[model samples]
Target: MEYTFDQAAALLNMGRNTLIRRLREEGMLGTDNLPTSRWRGRGVFRVITKMYRHPVAGYIHYGRTVITVKGLNAVSRKLRLAQHQPEGSRNRASWVN
Candidate 1:
């Protein structure tokens, strides 16, 4: 099953924005707050877009990023590893698991 960002964050014991920022920093997410192509191909995340008709603006689209089970596991593991990094060791894209 997929989870909304807020739900995923809660499951991961983090705040919503923190998760998004971390994912973006890790190159798993784009500036649009959706999964990047690499991560998407890995079955990590999905963006669901809904369209609504506005009285004056016609169709309006809204996108929401959801985390798959695989994504939750990947992100949770990454966050745990990040917290246990060696002193002076920095977070890097290569270390993302």
Candidate 2:
């Protein structure tokens, strides 16, 4: 599911240059062949995969936004537990019941 600069820009609904600039600033792209200014030529860029750890979750980028696998798992476990709880059980509150 790797995406090129053009694909990523289109998917994010952002200009190609803007996406490139963000990736460059984030150190996810090499700066060697970049234009001196935004008004210059389209800079050569590549997506660099990275892993980020938040206080309560871990995330990975697949080009557009960070996906929090750990957070999803935690939420899924909670949902499953709620689904299995018996009706009128103390564990099943009004909000989750």
Candidate 3:
């Protein structure tokens, strides 16, 4: 299942803004950071956006954004690995096992 930004933030125990920044940094958001294939069948998060306009008012509202379970797991795994790493250690290969 997918999760809205707010829900994902809550699950990760971080502020929504901080979560968003992390997602963007991890290439879980935005098209600019996407690969040449454009994320199709790429096991990455795709942005689902809905534009809304009020019936009586002239205001536009953007809907909540969401990410997939896979993306969330990826984020969680990255965080776990990051937390276990020693500072200033460039030998990430050793972390695999």
Candidate of highest lDDT: 1
87 Cα displacement, candidate 2 (Å):
37
Question: Could you report the Cα RMSD, in angstroms, for every candidate shown?
Answer: 8.8, 18.3, 9.0
C-alpha displacement of 69 in model 2, angstroms?
A: 13
Model 2 stretches astray by more than 4 angstroms: 33-97
Which scores higher on lDDT, 2 or 3? Answer: 3
1-97, model 1: which lDDT tens digit per residue? 7888898877667789998899888888899997788877777787899999999999999888888766776877766632222224355433335
Error of 1 at 84 (Å): 17
* Decoy 1 TM-score against native: 0.73
Better of 1 and 3 by lDDT: 1
What's the lDDT for all of these models? 0.75, 0.40, 0.57
Residue-pair clashes per prediction, in order, are 0, 0, 0
Cα TM-score per model: 0.73, 0.32, 0.52
Task: Sort every candidate by lDDT, greatest first.
Answer: 1, 3, 2
Candidate 3 segments exceeding 4 Å error: 31-40, 53-64, 81-97
Write the residue-wise lDDT of candidate 2 on 1-97 in tens digits. 3344465455456666775676556443446423235423322222245567666765744433321222222222432322222234556453231
What ranking of all candidate models by TM-score puts the best one first?
Answer: 1, 3, 2
Q: Write the per-residue lDDT of candidate 3 for residues 1-97, one digit (tens) a residue.
A: 6677787677777877887776567655563433224444655455455566788876774534565666566667755533223234557544333
